[model samples]
Target: VDDLCDRAVKASFASAGQGSYGEVSVLLTNDLAMCEFNSQYRGREGPANVLSFPAHLRSAHSRVEVEPLLWGDIAISFDRVKYEAKCEAKPIRDHTAHLVVHGTLHLLGFDHKEMLDIAAMKRLEVSSLARLGISDPYSAGVNVELSAL
Candidate 1:
């Protein structure tokens, strides 16, 4: 999981034209915990595959000088990710990597609220996943159940 998180983060930074010198928390948890977070933060009722909470909010107010930027926290639900992977006919590792990349992009302030934003974000995810040797997640008949980030 740690290795996967590292690769996802690196890919995200590269795609975003940023240097990867920050710390991001990757929490691998279960469905119940994720449901609670989803409800509390997003006002959603179900568990999402992944969730991101950016640390920029803290840096915006803090005066401390840190070498590495503290990017954010990403929480992933193992059960949800697994289910999604199976449903999409994708390998679990590939699906997990995609979620990490998605969450990292969210921490960097990338969102998909609008059509243009969705296109841009999807392009980044596809490119990053390709670098990791994964195929385009949105290609052909693939259906990815994405959550609101």
Candidate 2:
């Protein structure tokens, strides 16, 4: 997980055109835990594959001079990720990498609420996954049931 996170973070930074210090926490847990978080924060009732909470709001008023950018936290459900990978015929490692990239983009303020924004985010995800040698998860023939980031 550590190695995967390292690669994902590097890809995220490159995609965002950011070269400064930043940190994001990634939590890999079960469906139950994910469900709790989903309900508590997103007002959704199911376990999501990935959920990101940006720290921008928390740090908006901070005046610290030496603080690294606290990008945010990402929570992922292990069971859901495995199931989705199997259903999509994608390797688990690759799928996990893709989720990290998706979540990181959210932490950086990317959203899929608009078509144009979704397109831009998808391009970044594709390029970042390519850097990790992972195929495009949204390509034709793959299931697209995964929720928007």
* Cα lDDT, all candidates: 0.83, 0.78
lDDT of 1 by residue, 50-121 (tens): 898987743211333552468889999999888988888888999999999998888777887778888888
Q: Residues 1-149, candidate 2, lDDT per residue (tens digit)?
A: 88997798689768766654778889999999988998988889988889888877432223345535687889888898899888877888988888888888787777887788778888988998888888878885675444524
Q: Would you estimate the TM-scores of all the predictions?
A: 0.89, 0.88
Best by TM-score: 1
Q: Which ten residues in a row have the lowest lDDT in candidate 1?
A: 58-67
**Native-to-model Cα distance after best TM-score fit, residue 17 in candidate 1, in Å:** 0.8
